[model samples]
Target chain A: MSQILVEALAKTYRVAERAPGLSGALSGLVRRRWREVHALAGVSFSLEAGELLAFIGPNGAGKSTTVKILSGILRPTSGRVEVGGLVPYEDRIRHVARIGVVFGQRSQLWWDLPVLDGFDLLADIYRVEPARYRKRRDELVSMLRLEPLLAQPVRQLSLGQRMRAEFAAALLHDPQILFLDEPTIGLDAPSKLAVREFVRRLNREQGVTVLLTTHDMHDVEALAERVIVIGHGRVLTDSPFASLRSGVFAERRLHVDFAGPAPEITMPGVTVRSRDEGSLELAFNPADIPAPQLIAAITAQHAVDDIHVDEVAIEEVIARFYDLHDAREA
Target chain B: MAPLRPYLAAFRARFQLLLEYRVAALAGFATQLWWGGIRIMVFAAFYGAHAAAAPISLADAITYVWLGQALLALQPWSADPEIGHAVRTGGVGYDSLRPLDAYGFWYARSLGWMLARALPRAVLMVLFAGFVLPLVGLGEWAWRPPSSLEAALLFIPAFVLMAALAAAVLMLANIVVAATLNERGVNSILTPVVIVFSGSMLPLNFYPKAWQSWLHLQPLAGIVDVPFRIYFADLHGGAALQGLALQAGWTLVLVAIGRLAMARMMRRLEMQGG
Candidate 1:
């Protein structure tokens, strides 16, 4: 079943046009002016039950705006968004109860209160029954390893510690869907890995539908099965993560080391990307010259001691996707 | 049983947060003590020079001053800045997403916090004033003390209603401010207004009749008027109850408007993109 549906999700903002200097500022006071900026333009997508989808885009690409609309905090300028068979904005109180949201930059916890107090308060805010709240809170505490941290005030906890508590707090209601906006943006290396591992387990084992928006390509590579690339307030591409990377920009690098000075072996459909002492890097399109053919070409004329192939990084693939979309639009 | 239960639960959490500030709580009481002392001296200097033939008795005046000082911390306008902060910081997004009613949550939280501050100050002011009143020779060692029996009946409800009224008005004012500006801007404008109109700086009686009449009709004066009238005018029975009713009426009216405005503004808020 489709768990989320968004159609033509457009949001435009009327921003006050303030002038550059004192004279313009004085003039603006007499006659205020506004210019409309379309934050999202006809965005549309759908997610099936228990799907792990990574929503990625550059800054100001409407990633957070989409999340906000879906979570019921924002009403779209014109669009239809149905989560769990209800319009999120119209039935916000009912719809929001079933989903949880976590923003990496902000915390939902009361800063002066202990972590347990915050979780307990959330239990009340979500109207979770005492018995159910207790059971779920305990489960989340254990899952997030928040036992020791629960007694400390939210302000007292370190960022990593606080983030774990935040994740647990959002889930204490046992929300069916989790919307994480850059959940691991500024964490240290180990903390980032821990969050990634936890998210992976939550999606695979628990079947909790996860829609995560992030700048980190590694997070997408580590957790998301499908990727939705949005840019300029539109979804440019949506496909399986692996296929999206492989389908576009198929240039792969093959580095071969020879026992002697590298031979300039030239072949059709194969171009030398770079070369170093006793090693050469060749770029080739698999459609024209397959990896095996390229390897054969190198081995045919050169005494190759070692060799390895590197596919394009996902970041490069996404950048190329952006360039391709921009070029077509232009 | 349905929505009320969760609101109560949230209120309990809010209460806990309000009382967690031990040092601020103590400092709050100390400041009330200082103000009480200074205001009592003002009354002393007046009674000391003039012949004691005024309609407002020295005893009643003394009690009024002390309670007014004590009640300053309990006034409802406390929640306005919080609303402003929420609006300014974009934290209102998370709050709006919660299943609770935005106005009710803030109103309850403000009431809880006022109780936290007010309860302590009330105790210390009564105790310290009890000690100092005699030394100053202000009547029979008690400034209109209702005996132990009347204390049980009138003062508890009086303070509670006062706090609730204050919270409601403050929350309403905050909703208006939140719709337009952030907390810092609201605080800058609203604090002086609260100080002037609520009679925190001086009792409404001290103001001219027209000013007093205007302030009395407002939500601010409504919060402070009942407690002041009950303590100073020696009003009881129907009149005192009516004062309490006015406080209740204002609280209900303001809270209703606040809730409606909050719901409307929350709908219009574009927190994520803005």
Candidate 2:
């Protein structure tokens, strides 16, 4: 059974539009103007138990909007959204107790309270049993390395340290599904790695389903096997990372360092993409020119000291997808 | 019992949190003291002017002023600015997800803050009034604990109903302000209205006859004025019981209205996405 299901779920906001200056403000009060912004346009997706999917998009791409709707925070304007067999907006309290949400930019911990105090308060809020709460809290604290920070007031902790506390707070109830919205944002290198590692283990070892939305491509690359890209209130692509890479840019680069000055290497199937001095970079589809044939031809033609092949960057692949999406819209 | 347990725990936690900020609580109490002290002086001035042909004894007027000052500290009709803060900051979304009821959680927290603010202020007002009022010939005022029968029958219920009504009225105001401005400025503007109608600044007795009648009908008057009239003055008969009933009735009605408004607003709520 699917852990989360959303079908044709749409949400539109009636936003007040105002011009600048005092006269405009007075006119707005007398006769206000509103523009409808379609935040989510028939967005539909489903997730299975223990599935870790990255929901990626550009700014204002309805990523957090979808997360809020799924987590029972905001009601969708139209269509159906079911998580764990319950309509999220209608059964908000029941649904929320079963799902954990961690927003990287905001700490859920109480400002004046110690980290443990916030966790204990959450235990009360969720009505978790004392024994189970203690066990889960201890496990999450250890996994997130929050023992040292547990006694400190939340306001006293650094952003990275506080993010660890937030993770522990969200998991204190032992929720089955986790929605992470930019959970590793603003973290240092070590903290980011720790968070990624923990999220990976949580999904793989504990069978906790995860739906993560982030601007950090590295987070998607490190954790999510499957990526779902959305733009302008629509899903652009949903596929495994490898499939995306291979399908978008299958051609690889071959960097050749010649023993002497290299000659201009120009072939029908292969072309020199970049070069400087003795080193030459080549690009060609593998189907058109086999790597072995290309290498042999290069070696035969020039004295090569070293050679290496590189895949296209994931950022470039996503940029191409965005350009395609925009062109279609235009 | 099941539903009430969560509220009880929340109430306790809220009380603990409020108590931790002892210095802030003391400062809030001091501010209340300054206001009450000024009102008490105003009463003494009035007594001095009318001493020659005093309609009521100087002691009675002094007692009435002091009781009004004390009860004003316990007035629950003040809005919590945090509700607006929570909504604007997107924290209210998480609050809505708690398993406990939203109205009960806020009510309990507000009650906890009232006690934190009121208890110290009551003590300070009593001490300060005792020292200052008598020197100005406001006459002797004694700690006349309500006679046993009156205590058992009148004061307890009157106090409870009055506080509940104040809290409920403030809560309704909170909902309206939260919906309109997503801020608590509406309540700030209405504070003077509460003071005038609730007889916190002076006894409702001093107001014009028609205005007094209208003020009596308001929820604010039931909170402090009616209770003050019963306890501080030697008002005859079951006026205390009747006023208590009126206060309780208003509390129930306001609470129901506030809850309905909150539910509707929450359904249409939108949080800023960052």
Candidate 3:
């Protein structure tokens, strides 16, 4: 059986609506209108143990809603969600004990307490035995480079520092599954890399099942083995990262810097994307004509200064994907 | 022991964090002293007007006023501020992630916040009103000691129950705030109700005779009037036990209601951000 299974999950929210003026506000006091929002519309997916899956979507795409449901924070309107053989919402206490969650926009640590004290409180909250807690605390402290940060109050730490402390706080109990919602949001380049590296190590070395939702495509490229692209509360694609990339756009770009004025390339599968005085850009499908053969055909007839092939940017692919499905936030 | 560890830890951490706000404690003590002085003068005038017809003696009235000021923070004047802030900012979602009973966790923290804020002021009020007034030859106006040895002994458990009852009441307020997603309406309504019914504004005895029994039996009375009455031995013997029972009963009832409300609210909770 899959370690995490969500079948036909649906969550609808009744939002109170009102009109735009004082008269509307006064009338709203007497009678209110409510609109139902379908946050999750029959979404289904499953993850085996130790699998790292990246859940990517635009804003308001129900990514966080799904994570909240799976983590037992919110009960879905209708669905079956089981984590480690326990229904997440029904058996919350038992299920939550086995999963660690970090919502990067929020801090779990007490703002006024020192980082170490917050960790101690979490240790007790999770009821880890004293000796085992000490070992785990020391390991996480060193791993996240939180030793120097232990004495500083959480309010005083920078965003990067606090995020590291949050990661340690969430994992202090050695949970089997970790759910990270936009864990690298608002982080600098180095901090983002550090977060990615730590998550990768935790997933690979510790064999921890990780479900990450992020807008950072680099996070998906670097950490996730499988990707699930969700849009409008529905999973659009679930496959290996490479396959998703290929499936979305198979056309690769080749930029060539010719030794002389660029020559026209008239291949069956290739088209000239752009032509400049001393350079040429061509788009081609590798399946139609292999890169090596195309390169050989080019060099065989013309002098080539430099040539390199590049895949489309991941951000562009996701934007195009969102467009294809009309999944942009309303 | 293991099951209770999380609540205990939450309590201790909040207690320690709140204790660090020494300035707030000092400011509160000063404010309470000002109010205590005004209330004592008002009672002295009222007693002078009808000395023989008064329900209690002026000295006991003075002590009750001092005690009310000293422990005013124990009243469930509003929901826990941290919980209110969490509800507004959507941080309340993080609270549900913990593998513990939600009501118990919040109740522990509320108890800690109340006690920590009340303790220093209580000690300071005792030092000034109990000792300094007597040393300065104004003993009649001072906060007197418990009326008898038995009253002193019973006051201990009463005090503990008072804290529990306050936390329970505050938990209900917190649930309301969570359900409404706004603290202003509940808090504005709660403050006046708590002030009047908790006997902080005036002892229940001072109220009209017809309303006396109902006032004494109400839950907020356990927070102030019952406990303070026990301290003065006014509700002694079987009556004192009744007061303690009232405190305990109300605490349990409020906690039960709070637990139910919290469960219902959490089921429908929708965290509004990604």
Compare the candidates by lDDT and give the number of the best one.
Answer: 3
Per-residue lDDT tens digits for candidate 3, residues B1-274, read 7779999999999999989999999999999999999999999898889999887789889999999999989898988999989989888888888999989989999999999999999999999999999999999899999999999999999999999999999999999998998889999999999999998888888899999878988999999999999999889999999999999999999999989999999987888766
* DockQ, every prediction: 0.61, 0.45, 0.79
TM-score, chain B only, every model? 0.84, 0.85, 0.98
Candidate 1 Cα outliers beyond 4 Å, as residue runs: A249-316, A327-330, B49-55, B77-81, B131-144, B147-152, B210-215, B272-274
Off by over 4 Å in 2: A19-26, A249-316, A326-330, B51-57, B67-78, B124-149, B182-184, B233-237
Between candidates 1 and 2, the one scoring higher on TM-score is 1
Q: Each model's RMSD to truth, in Å?
A: 3.8, 4.3, 3.3
Give candidate 3 misplaced runs (Cα > 4 Å).
Answer: A22-31, A249-315, A322-330
- Write down the worst ten-residue block by lDDT for model 1 chain A: A321-330
| TM-score of chain A, all candidates | 0.83, 0.83, 0.83
- Per-residue lDDT tens digits of candidate 1, residues A1-330? 589999999999888898899998999999989998778999999999899999987777889999989998889999888998999888878888899999998899989888998887788788888899888888878888899998899999988998899899888888889999999989988888889988888888889999999988789889988999887788999889888656664678888999899777678877887888898888778988899988886788778799999876656666777788882233
Task: Say which prediction, candidate 1 or candidate 2, comes out ahead on lDDT.
Answer: 1
Per-residue accuracy of model 1 over B85-166 as CA lDDT, tens digit each? 7777888888767876677777776666667677767776777676666777854525456534554476668767777778
> What is the C-alpha local distance difference test score of candidate 3?
0.91
Model 2 TM-score (2 dp): 0.86
